[model samples]
Target chain A: MIIDINAFLGHYPFRRLPHNSARTMIELMDAHGIDSAVVSSLHSVFYRDAHRGNEDLFLETKDFGSRFVRVATVNPKYVSWRRDLDEAMDRWKMKAVTLFPAHHGYLLSDVECQQAIEEIVRRDIPLVLTQRLEDRRQRHHWDAAEDLEFKSVLELVRQHTKLRLALVNWIGLDGKRMAEAGLQGRCLIDFARLHVLLNKDVDKLISSLGITSIAFGTHMPFDYVGPSLVKLANLESNPAIDYPAVSWRNAARFFGLEGGD
Target chain B: MRKIDVHNHVFDAVDQPGANWARVESMIEAAEWLGIETLCCSRPITGGAMAEIAEVRRANDAVLATMQRYPDRVRGFCFIQPGNGRLAIDEMQRCFDQGMIGVKLYNQFKYADPMVYPIAEKCIELRIPLLGHSAHLTDARSIAAQPMTSDSLEFCKLATRFPELILILGHINGGGDWEWAIKGLRECENVYLDTSGSVLENDTIEMCVRELGVKRILFATDQTMEGCVGKILSAQLSSEQREDIFWKNAHAIFARRTS
Candidate 1:
């Protein structure tokens, strides 16, 4: 069973996405053997107030039940973001929250951002940070999602030792740093951007970092599921690594799901 | 099904001293896992910056040596630094003599530059395809970098000048407006789009197949075989269309030098 920690719903304003609807998302997950996914809304990305998109996401995935778990977004740039976070937690029953600091034009070091993260920790919910929505080289000409500085994210992770964090869409050397920093076991990383294929780099990562801190995340709707699955499948062949842990066990455990499916 | 990867790099890391050879080995293993039959390998243009003619020769020689080591699995492309006019031509001749099949031009100079015309003429005379690094220019930052980079429009201009030369627009998915890139090169039949680079946007492969026929798209990984092949496999295309992009088109394009 595959549990995708990073998936999205709603339309990406710049390009055409194949599985933007809830139905198509489920179809894609089923086709790719993804049992469950933590989904955020792309509407949250473009809309000025992410609370509206969060509400839309909650309404959209509420019907699918356990197959799709809602991961609401809160743009801390808003003055009333704390109230929105409360509604997302208590009213929406979102399993986790996603921060688009870059898109929202705020630093992770901002007081509001730190307070929101502290609250997320207080609630005992996981916080997923999407480092980038699109490849830096291929961002849309008019408006592109700026990336959150890696050093800033590292600083946030170091300060909030009690917070459960997972970073998504980081690639190459940045991914290596995330894995190294995740040694604390409080933070985890999604394999979608790592592109760890069958190689010594992944092997070393599994051996040194431990497989429990790694989770499968497909940046779907914007990206394809095939590469993430292929990476997982390739890593599964090594006897030293645990495929179940990376694929679903770690995510299920982190999100407090029962039995890891 | 057989597959040919047109855009692949073979270089040892100068920054990370000990990691070079292992990286190359891992790349080959990854290619084998993806079932790629032949990889057109060249020394990455970005590596070592290719600032001097000697560096260019060293990079091409490295590719030649790699091709020799794995004759059946690998094909070499002589990377040229057009700024080194006469030396670049001599290196191209040397590479051809050493059984290199094609010429690889990177961001050293724009494809439309007068310095590149001689290289294009040589490729035509040698009956070899010229693989060029091309992307869509977005802003002033990219415009300033244009002396070393070529967008699809530049490639279109180059193709118009040399209609007989087979030009490949490498990484049509890399940056800028891909729709503009595709439309800009739509009239240039000699120019082909390489499906590589880091951007695997949904329906991009389908868009390429729709705009440019299946034969015009070449499946390439740009060193990340799994990621690249995954993009092709996930593309919503018919089996025949997949075959054409995966192997048939590449085979036809590369078969020219032999013919």
Candidate 2:
């Protein structure tokens, strides 16, 4: 079963963009052979902080049952961080948390930020950090979302050695230099953009980094499902290496769902 | 799904950069996924006078290498760098001798850029088709920054001089920049619209197919920066229109091989 780790659930800035409803999103996922997804809300990333998005996520996941896994998005800079996170954890039963450092404008190395990360790690929930959602070249609505500060992320990972950080939107070209600099296995990465790299090249990266380091992600509403599905189907390599593990097995293990198989 | 990708690139093994090889392999994998057949041109051919003859030769060799690496999946064009008419003629002759199919020109430079005219004339003389980039230079903002407008007009003039030569105005889908080129080529029987480039919302193909016939529209994917075959399939065209645009017309143009 494929699990999309990069999926989103809330109304984004796309007030005019044609998109699938929650029900249609499930249908499209099924159409593309994706069985389950771990989703967050863009609204949570934008306004009312992660607390509000987490509330909406709980509501949305209710209809999908186990098909939709909830990830609470929190603003490290928010004043009510501890209270909001405690409520999200005790009430909503969230398994993971996503951080929007760029949107929230908080450095990963901020002392207060480290406290928040510590709280999330203390709860044994995986932390997902989204880099950027759209291509910078595309016409944008505003200047808020820009290129992510990779150095800050690297530093954060180095400081919190035991934290299970999920870097969503991993790519073949961009993060390779860091991987060479000893950043390979510590963070769990989503494979939404890896579709751009296929065949023997994909095999090389997989052999070097175990399947557990990967996570399948759809980057829904922004990216079309066809390209990602087409690439995954045609990926060339040893069957075991190219098999669906990054998004499915990795998330399953991280979320304590051994019965996902 | 028999399909033709109008835009692509290849480089010589000896001269090709490592990153470029990786990019090409990735692109080939992408093409295989969509069951596409692609026509690859050399960087020298696409980049025009900016390329040297030796570099063009290496690029030609690279295109030959890519064709060899993926047999039956790739076709090629004899790229002519600007200002080298003698070399362009020599390259055209070599292409024919080496079994290359057509010609490609980046028509974004000065229309009458002295170096380009000879190649245009040579293409006409050789009876080979040339795919030209056409964007409008309505003002200076896009002109100095882009390589699209005036060159298309020059290409049209050459096409008028040689009626038998097949000239395709590429990226008709490129908004405003090439709108005039599209309008100008509508009256030219020998000139066709190669539907390729950017993810534009405006429906250029519909207008081309309506004003000109389906026979005049050729499907192309600028695969380096875009998805080659998937883009062709993604177009908001009818199945019949897509079928003709994607395969039939291209097959008819490069008719020698069994692609």
Candidate 3:
């Protein structure tokens, strides 16, 4: 079984996402042979009341059963974030909590963010962070959100030794840096944005971070599902790598699901 | 079905030099893994800035050697800097006659510049496609190090001047407002958009196919092999449309465009 560690539901502010609904998402998953996907609210990224997008995501994925796993985005900068995070956990049963620190106008190093991670860690849920949802260079003129700086991310990973952080749509990071920064197994990076062939970054990443730290993800609605699937294909073809860990095992374990190694 | 990657680079032996021969081998290994049959490759010398004519020729010679090494797998595109005036055309023709299939232009000069006209005309005379690098950006163009880079609007200008020129716009999805690029580039019936690079975004191929149609799109990776191919598969395209973009259109670019 394949689980997409990263996927999104809700309307993108700029440009049209033809497959923005849960129905289209399921269709895409079926097309790519992905059994499940951990989905978050794209609307939460733009909405000032971030929980409103969580509500939207809840209404959409609530009836879908286990095929869709909800990932709630909590903005620590927002005043109601403390109450919202608890509400998301208790009511929405959010399996994971994602933070768009860059878009939320805060740093991963912030006290507010640190507190949030503390809360997430205590609850035993993985904290989802992303380098970017969109390629900054290709962003719409209005999308001025800066990418997550590596130093801030490194800072957080070092501080929270037990925090399980799934980094989605990340680029340019290799295994060596992860080892040096002591960010290896604690952080799980998805392949939605990693170049499997061009840079052969996956080869470098697996060598340093080990297969367990890598997971499958597709930044859908904003991006295609096929890149990660094809990446899995490439991984399977490589005799040295364990394809199942990247394909679903790591993601399943990271999300606290069944079917993990 | 076979695939033709119309635009990618040869990064071995200067360009960055033989320091990266392993990289060249890895690119071939990737192409083979992905089922890519032909790689229309070049060695872009300007590196991201303007280059002298001699420097440009040296880079093209790298492509010549790469093409010779791969032979059937690798095809060459003689890279040129339009600012070099007649010398640019001389190098372009020299490489073409010596088996380079097309011309590759970077961001040193915009597409609409007078210097580009002669090169475009040279492409017309040789019946070869001209692959011009572009990025559709607005306020923060300087950050990308492509100050004078051509956008879709400039490509439109050049296409209007030389209707017969087989102008393949490099990497519509390379980076920057692709929706803007698609809408802005709609009128240039002759400018074929190579769906490459930022195929990261879903529906890019569908939007491109919708705006530019099947016959005007070509498949390329600009180094992002899986993303580029995946972009086409993600699009709602017919078999015929896919075939056209994959090879037929790019194949036609090399055949006599005097039609």
Top model number, DockQ: 3
Clashing pairs in 1: none
Query: How would the candidate models be sorted by DockQ, starting from the highest?
Result: 3, 1, 2
Which residues of candidate 3, in runs, are more than 4 Å off? B14-20, B139-144, B257-259
lDDT (Cα atoms) of all candidates against the true structure: 0.81, 0.64, 0.84
| Model 2 residue A141 CA deviation in Å | 6.5
Tens digits of per-residue lDDT for model 2, A113-192: 89998988788778887777654333233635654666777677677766777777655433564465455655567655
Model 1 stretches astray by more than 4 angstroms? A141-144, A172-183, A198-201, B13-20, B47-50, B139-147
Cα lDDT tens digits, model 2, B1-259, are: 6778765666435335553577567667767756676654544444324666776677677777676667677777877666564876797778767766777766535544656667667666665677766665444434445554443566567667767677777666553344455567666777777766543322345567777788888877665223234334444468888889988887787763323
The prediction achieving the highest lDDT against the true structure is 3
How do these models rank on lDDT, best leading?
Answer: 3, 1, 2
lDDT of 1 by residue, A1-261 (tens): 889988899988777788988989999888879999888999998899999999889888889988888887988778798889889888888888988887888778988888888888899888988877876555566665566667887787778777887777665434456555654466667877676754444555555556777888888988888878888877787677788888888898888787855
**Candidate 1 vs candidate 3: which has greater lDDT?**
3
| Model 1, position A114: C-alpha lDDT score | 87
Worst lDDT run of 10 residues, candidate 1 chain A, spans A198-207
lDDT of 3 at B199: 50
